[model samples]
Target: MSSSLLCLVFLFFTIVAEATYSPGGFHHLSSLRQNKKASKSKPKLPFETRYFPQNLDHFSFTPESYKVFYQKYLINNRFWRKGGPIFVYTGNEGDIDWFATNTGFMSDIAPKFRALLVFIEHRFYGESMPFGKKLHKSPETLGYLSSQQALADYAILIRSLKQNLSSEASPVVVFGGSYGGMLAAWFRLKYPHITIGALASSAPILHFDNIVPLTSFYDAISQDFKDASVNCFNVIKRSWEELDAISTKKNGLPELSKKFRTCKGLHSQYSTRDWLMGAFVYTAMVNYATAANFMAPLPGYPVEEMCKIVDKFPRGSSNLDCAFAAASLYYNYSGSEKCFKIEQQTDDHGLDGWQWQACTEMVMPMSCSNQSMFPPYDNDYEAFKENCMSRYGVKPRPHWITTEFGGMKIETVLKRFGSNIIFSNGMQDPWSRGGVLKNISSSIVALVTKKGAHHADLRAATKDDPEWLKEQRRQEIAIIEKWISDYYRDLKED
Candidate 1:
C-alpha cells in the first residue's frame, strides 16, 4: 500500500480500537439489540466499496474544482421487492462498516419491509477521504468536510443510486443515530423529494446555538452515576478533588502515575487526566441493559457496575486509588497493558483527522464542572474558538449549524416542509436534551424512552430489552410502515 493508504489503514484500526468503547471522542449512539436470553449473532452484510465525485460544487466559485472521487460502501441484501422502499443509513464519523454492523435495526426491518439496505461512508472519515491522507491533514482541503457538503453527498449518491437501480418509484427512508441521525432528519427536511421519511435517534439537533444548555452533556453523565448509586457519585466527586490535589503537589504527577499505573510519568498536559475521566463518560453513554461492544466490552448497566466498585472501595484506600480502580474498569478491562498511556487516546492519525473535524464544523460545546460529577473545567467560547483557529486555521462556528439548518426554528420548518421524521431520544442521554423530545406535528414525532441510553431504540430488538424499548421499537416500525404506505399513496395521486 502507498503511504497515504497505510495512513488510512492505521487510522481505521485506531478508530476501531477506540470504538470498542467510543469513537470520534464526541457523543455516539449504541444500537443493536437482541432478546435478553437470545444473543443473535449479526451476519456480515457484504458491501462493495464505491467512490463518488469530490467537488460537488457546481457554481464554479472556487479557483478550480478538483475532480476526485471518495469511497462509499454499501450493502444491498436484495430484500426489496418491486417498488419497495429503500433503507439508507446516513453514516457518521468513523467507518460505515461499523455502523452497518452494529445497527441491526435497519437490517431486521429491511427484511420485514423488503427494503434495500445501503450504508454511505461519511466524507473524510473511514475510507471515504476526499483528498486521500495527504490532503486530509491540509487545512485548505478540510474546509470541504462540512455537514452541508456531506448532506449534499448523500443527496447526490441516493439520486444516482435510484437512477442506476431503476428504483425511481421506490420511496427512500433514511436512518441514522447521533450525528448521522441529525443528518437523516436534516436530509428528509432538505431533500424530502429524495427520501420520504427519516428515523433520527439520539440526534442532538438543538445542541448547537444557545438553544440547549452547554452543561447538559456532563450533567446527564453525572446523573447516570447518581442514579446508579449516590455512593458512586460521591466517590467520583471526591476523586476529582483528590486527583487535582495530587496533580498540584510537588510529587503529584508521580503519585498519579503510580496510582493509575501510567507507562510513562504523568505529563503537564491536562488531557491525561481528562482521558482517564472520559472513560466514565463513555460508560454512562453506553450503559445498556446488556453488555455492549459499541465503545468497549462493557457489561450491562456499566454505570451501575462501576458504581458497585466505587461503593465497595476499601475504606483506607486513597480517593485517587479508588478513582484509578474505577477508571481501570473501562481503560484496563483486559488487563493487558503494562502501564496506562494517555498517548494511546490522542496520538492516532485517524483521531488527528477527527480532532480537526471537532476543531472546525463539529464544535461540540462539552465541558466538566463542579455542578456535575467532575471538577469545574470551563470550555468558554473564546478559548474554544482560539483552539480551533490555532489547530485547524478555521474558526469554530458555534451557531453555524443552527443558522444553516434551523435549530430551534426546526419545529416551524418541520411543520411546514417536514413530516415522517421520528426524533427519538433516551432520557438518560445527555445529548437527548438537545434533540426533539415531543411531537412537532402529527407526522413529525419524538419517541423518548426512560431506560433508553443514547440511540438504544436503533438497536435490533433484544429479548433483554425493557418493556418500554419493546414498545418503542414496535411504534417505530409502525411509523416507518405508515411512512412507506403514505409515500406510495401520494405517489399514486401524483
Candidate 2:
C-alpha cells in the first residue's frame, strides 16, 4: 500500500473505533437506551439471550481449531410461525443487546411478516471471545478473528438453527448496518444459498483498493456541515490554524483548557483535535431526522443544532470558543457531564478486537488533501507497518478486504453474482462515499436518501420520522417480502 493509503487507513479506523467502541463514544447507541431512567411500566425485553458453541477456527484441522467458545446471540420467536422466514441481525462491533434494542425496525415488522428475529454476536465481540481476553495476546489467536471466520460462523449457526427448529424450508434475510452491513452483503455473496437476501445499510464495501476517492469521507463530512451552515463550516475550517497558533503561546494550553472546559486540562493539540474530530464524525454518522440518542442525547438534526451553537457566537467571540461550544453540544448535550476528559480508557472488548482487525485484514485506505476541510496529511505506509508490527507483531494486509470481498469492479462483479442485496445509503453519512450508490442489477439495488445519515433506515420507526425515511423502510420491507415470496415460489417450482 502507498503512504497515502496508510494515512487513510489510520484516519478511518481511528475515527470509527473511537466513535463506535470508546466509552461515551459517539456511536454508542445502547448507552442511550441504558442510560434512560428506568420506569415501573418499562416493558420487558422481547428477546431471550442465548449462547452457541462456536468453532475457534472453521478452516484448519488442528487441535486448537477444534476448540469451541460460547458465542452470544439473541432470539425473539414471538412472531414466528411454521415455515416463516427468519430475520437475522449480523452484530457489529458492540454488544448484541445494544444492536437489538436500537434496531426497532425488525421488531416493528416481525409481526407483520411472521418472521423470527435473531441477532448473532460476531466472534470476539461482546461475550463471544474465542480465547477470552488472551485472544489479543498474539497474532495466532487474533488470526481467528477475520471477517471470513465471522461469516462462516453466521452460516453454520443459521444451518444449525434451521435444523433445530425444523424450519429448513424457511427463507432467511440478513440485516446489518455499517460493518455488520458489509458482512450482510458478503454473506449473501459468499453464501447465497444460506440467505435469501441482505439489507446492507451504510455498508462501505467499496472503501478498499482506491475504489472511492481517498478524500471522499472527510469531504462528505465537510459537506454535511456546509449544508447545515456555511458560516459554521468556515469557522471550523479556520479554527484549526487558530488552535495551532494558540497552542504555541505561553499559557496557551491553560487558556484552551479554560475555553474547552477540559477535565484534565489541555496537554497537546493532538488530543484536542481528536476530541473535536470525533464529535463531528460521529454526529454525522447518526444525524437522524428527529432527536436521537444513538451517540448521545442529541437534538433533532444534531449537525444543524451544533452549527446553530457555533453560529450563535457573538462577533468578537473567539473561533476556538465557538468550536468548543459546538463540540460540547455533542459531548455534553445531556448536561450531565461536568468536564470533558481528553482521553479515557474503556473495558470494551470489541475495541481490542477491532484494533487487531484494523492492524490485519480490515484495512480501508483514506487520506485528506488541501481540497478537504480537514488538514492535509500524507500517508506513510512504512510508519503504519512499523506501528502495527510493534503493537501486534503483524503487518496490515491492505489488499485482503478487496481480495476477499471484491471492491474493485464491484458493480460488474456483483451484477454477475449478487442478488437480493439492498445497498441503502444516506448521503449525509461520510461512509456513503465508499458505498454503492447506484443499482447494480434488478435484485442488487441501491436505495439512496439525501437527508439520511448513517443507517437511519434501520433504526426503529418513530412518529417523528420524516416521510422519506418512512417510505425508505416501506420499500425495504416490500423488497424483502418479494425475496421471501420468490424463494417459496422457487421451492414449489423445484
Candidate 3:
C-alpha cells in the first residue's frame, strides 16, 4: 500500500474515514448487523462527552504551556459500585467515541467486574486536537503530540478522575486494540502505579528495529487471501501487471476509469492503484466472521467474500475488470460516493493526523516484495525520511518506540514487572506477527487464535464468534479477577 493509504488503514478500527466522527447514536456493527430486523428494540447506553486539558509541553512548565483544548472522553458508570474496578480504553488515532462504540467487549465484561468504563481520546486526534484547525499550520504545535506525552495525559487524567470520583482504591485495568492496544501496554509499563494490568489486543508492539520484518505486514495481508484461495492471490498479483500495461497504452486512464465504473475520470494511475491496495489491506484487517462496519461496510469473512468475487472471472473478461469488481466490494459497499476520491486531507478517521504520526515516531516500515502478493515497491528509509522532512519538517524516528519501550527487551520487562497482562492476537491478523504470542512469565500470557481477525476478540461477543474467542475471554476474565484480588491482598499486606 502507498504510505498515505497505509496511514488511512492504521486508523481503520479507530478513525471514521467514510463517516463523520461525531458523538451520536451509533451501535456496534456486530449487534446492529445481527439485529437488522429488530433495530427499534435495541437499547442504547447514554454516554456523556467531556473534555480535559491539552498541556502543550508535558515535560516543561512554562506560562505558555498551560493551554486547554477539548480531549473528548466517554464515561459509563451504569455497572459500577462505589469502589469497583475501572476499565480505561486508551483511544487511538480517531475520535474517542468511535472506540467506545466499537469496544463492546469492555462493556460485556464491565458488569461482571462492576467496573467503570472510561474511553479517553488521544492527543492531536479526533476532537482532542491541541491546535484546532491550525494544528498542521505551525509544525511547532505538533511537537507536543507524542506517544510519551499521550501516556502522560492518561496518567494525569486518570489520577484526576480518581480524585474527583473518590475511587482511588479502585483497581484500574487498561484496555485497547491495535494502536490503542500499544498505548495500553506502554501505559502499564510507564505507569504501573496507576494501572494494575493491561489488555493489549492485536498490538504490533515489536514492529520496529527489525524485531519483526518490515515486510511482515503486507506478507500477512497476502496470506489472508492465499489461505482463502491461492487462485485469488494469483489473480490479484496478475491484475497489477495488467494495470501497469494498460496505463502505458493510449487513452489508458479514461479506459481504466470506465472499466472500474469510477465516478470521476482518472487523473493518476498511481493514486487509483494505491486506493485499491488500501482496500485489500483494510479488508484483511476487519475480516471478522460476522458482518462489521468498523471502517467500511464489510460483510463477515471479507477475504473469503473477496475471493468469491475474484474466482468468478468470466471468460474473456479483462483482468482490470476482475480487480475492479473485487475492489468495489469494499469501496462501494454503501453505494453513496459518486466517484472514488483518495483525499489527501483529513478524513473522519483523522488520516492527516495519522499521517503526521507515521512521519514522526510511529514509522512502521511498510514495503512490498516478490514474497508478497503485490509487485515489488521500493521502501527506501532515506527517501521516507526526506519526504517527512519536506512535508512536516520532522524526520522519521524508526527506533524511538522500541528505544523507549521494550522491543527486544520484552523478556526483561516481563521478568522485572510484567504480571496480569494479556496480549491477545489473532493468527489471521497481520499485526499479530509483531505482538507477543508466547507466555513470557507466570502472569503474562499471550492468547492466539486461528479463526480470528485483527482484534476480533475485542469486539462485542456474538453467537457466531469462534470458540477460541469465547475461551480467550473466559481466561481474560479469570486473570483480571485475580489481579483485582491480588491488588487488594497486597494492599492489606502492606
Candidate of highest TM-score = 2
**Local accuracy of candidate 1 as per-residue lDDT tens digits, 269-325:** 353455545577667767778776665567787888888888787776677666667
Q: Candidate 3, which segments miss by more than 4 Å at Cα?
A: 1-8, 11-45, 334-339, 342-346
In candidate 1, stretches whose alpha carbon ends up further than 4 angstroms from where it belongs are: 1-44, 53-63, 269-272, 346-351
Please provide, for model 3 over 39-130, each residue's C-alpha lDDT reduced to its tens digit, 9 standing for 90 to 100.
22223555777887656667887876787776778898999987789999998876676677678999999888889989998888777887
Predicted candidate 2 versus true structure: per-residue lDDT over 150-200, tens digit per residue: 999999999999999999999999999888888898999999889999999
- Residue 184 lDDT, candidate 1, scale 0-100: 92
Cα lDDT for residue 241, model 3? 83
Please identify which of the two predictions, 1 or 2, would achieve the higher TM-score against the true structure: 2
Could you give me the TM-score of model 3 versus the true structure? 0.90
Order the candidates by TM-score, highest first — what do you get? 2, 3, 1
TM-score of each: 0.88, 0.92, 0.90
Instruction: Point out the higher-scoring one by lDDT: 1 or 3.
Output: 3
lDDT of 2 at 413: 83
lDDT at 490 for candidate 1? 85
Candidates 2 and 3 compared by lDDT, better number: 2
- Backbone Cα, N, C clashes tallied per candidate: 13, 2, 1
